[model samples]
Target: MNALEKLKILGESAKYDLCNYVSPNLETYASGKIPGVYNSTSPDGHCMPLFKVLMTNKCSNDCKYCMNHSNRKFERYEYEPAELSRVFMDYYNKRYVEGLFLSSGVFKDIDSSMEKQVEVARILRDYGYDGYIHLKILPGTSYDLIKRAMSLADRVSVNIEAATPDGFEELTTTKNFKTDILKRMKWISRLSNDKNMAPSGQTTQFIVGAADESDEDILKRTNWLLDKFKIKRSYFSAFTPLENTPLENYESPHPKRTSRLYQADFLLSYYGFSFDELVFDENGNIETEVDPKYSFAMNNMDLFPVEVNEASYDELIRVPGIGMVSAERIITLRKRGLKIGKLEDLKNLGVAVKRAEPFVKLNKSYQSVLSF
Candidate 1:
């Protein structure tokens, strides 16, 4: 196929990887955004637009939840390293993209597939193109190959793909939960930020809902991964069943599960929240109707109305709508002898006052204003 034809097929195939996406609500961004224009935050916290696509969609593994799994029937496509590199350079030169996110469905073997992806990063660098690149490390790839890819890339990931090994075992026949995936994660952690290695560190994704795992199940693993590996971040992809896959008849998960997971992940990674403090319903899942922060605030009603002038950084962030930046701003302003006895003053400091009103004591009369 020609470049245009390859772009059409390969581009559609790669949408399943939501590594660059923080939210699935693209309808809100659909009108303003165009193809290959994805806003992904980098390791240093700069949100950069990426040119995301797959090296190939041809796979040998039949993960039941994957759209591009081997059992699925479709027009398979692969991009030669040179062809993809040239295409990416064209886009980069035109300023159509700021960086690249390259992933692939495992084809012949883990080594060959990973080499192909690393070659793309290598080729771009050979062309004197220095831009941000995030490469996906195939499960079971060797450390030598990983080291080579890490040298050329800013960040790399090995997709955990499921919440737990046993849960993943039920979803796929070929993958070994203990050896193939986790061992590779350990290798990445061992080599992170080493000489000529990926300075940004490692990240992994877990497919939600596909393995019949709850948000709590995902959170526990997320917390452990964060605390143990000191990994950069986690990405969540809600299980969307595709036709021709084994799970085609399975119901598509709500976006709220993805959204709530992101909220809880931030609370775990950034704000100081424990798994016990998460407000899960009887089903052992987070409440999809409310943001996890709001749910936590409701569950801890006795802790509400925290005095804005006195609440610590952690305490301020625990409230419904106050973010870390805003919380810090409140503290900075208070230290400047700014008495924040009113809602307007807090709002001026960047707090989402409406969301914070019920949870904070702006003043004794502030809570009564909304009767909230």
Candidate 2:
């Protein structure tokens, strides 16, 4: 196939990985200067169309839910290192994209597949192209290659795919959850620190609801990864059954469930939430219809209504709609002896006072706005 045809097939094939790392372009987003989707920042800072493609779709592993798994019958394509570099440059030079997100299916072994990806990156850098490049570290790739890949790429990642070992085995027989995937994550974490490379740091993805994994299970693993390995980011790709794949007959996971997962992740990472606070149903599932932050607040009612004028910064973030910025504003105003006079004052200061109403106490007496 020609380069365009290969790009079409490979790009379509790549749409499933569901890993997102692009920083938002807030300035022109409302006016529509940037593309709505697939736009991200390079490790070096340009924010626009990120050229995301897989090196190859051929695979050695049979991930049951995956469209490109080994046993799945489908036409495949491969991009030689030189061909990929030229194609990427064609797009880059024309200003079609500002960064590259390169990933691949493991065709032979980890090192070989990873090497092809590395060469694409090396070729880009060698051509004096210094935009952002995000590369995926295949399972079982060597430490030396890991170090090398990090050196040439702006950001690198090894997808945990499944949070736990046994859960991972249910999806693919070819990969050992710890031996192949987790071990590589450990290597990247160590190498990233020692070399000070991939300044955007490392990230991982979880295939949510695949292998019957619970939302709670995903959160626990995410917490552990953040605490133990310091993974820069974790992405969730809610399972969507593909035609002809082993899981084709299964139900696709809810998109709102995936959204709720992001909210829960934010609460834990930024809002100082613990697993104990996020109420899970009997089946270990988080509530799909509600935002996890609001749900967590509902469960811990006594903690609220937070006295906005008196609550600490940590306490304010836990209140449903009071974000970091508004919390800081409230704190600064309070430090200046500016008492938050009314709901309008809170709103003027940028608090989402509507959501915060039930959770925050009025500056006056024990009665809160929620009481009204």
lDDT of 2 by residue, 59-97 (tens): 898888888889888898899999989988988888877
Question: Which 10 residues in a row give candidate 1 its minimum summed lDDT?
Answer: 23-32
TM-score of each: 0.93, 0.92
Q: Which tens-of-lDDT digit does each residue in 130-241 have in candidate 1? A: 8788898888889899888889998888888788877898689988877887787788778884856787788888888888788888899889888777767888888888
Counting clashing residue pairs in each candidate, in order, gives 0, 1
**Poorest 10 consecutive residues of model 2 by lDDT?**
23-32
Displacement of residue 44 (Cα, Å) in model 1 is 7.7
Judged by whole-model lDDT over C-alpha atoms, candidate 2 comes out at 0.80
- Most accurate candidate by TM-score: 1
Which parts of model 1 are misplaced by more than 4 Å?
21-47, 363-366, 369-372
Q: Candidate 2, after superposition: displacement of residue 94 in Å?
A: 1.3
User: Residue 35 CA error for candidate 2 (Å)?
Assistant: 13
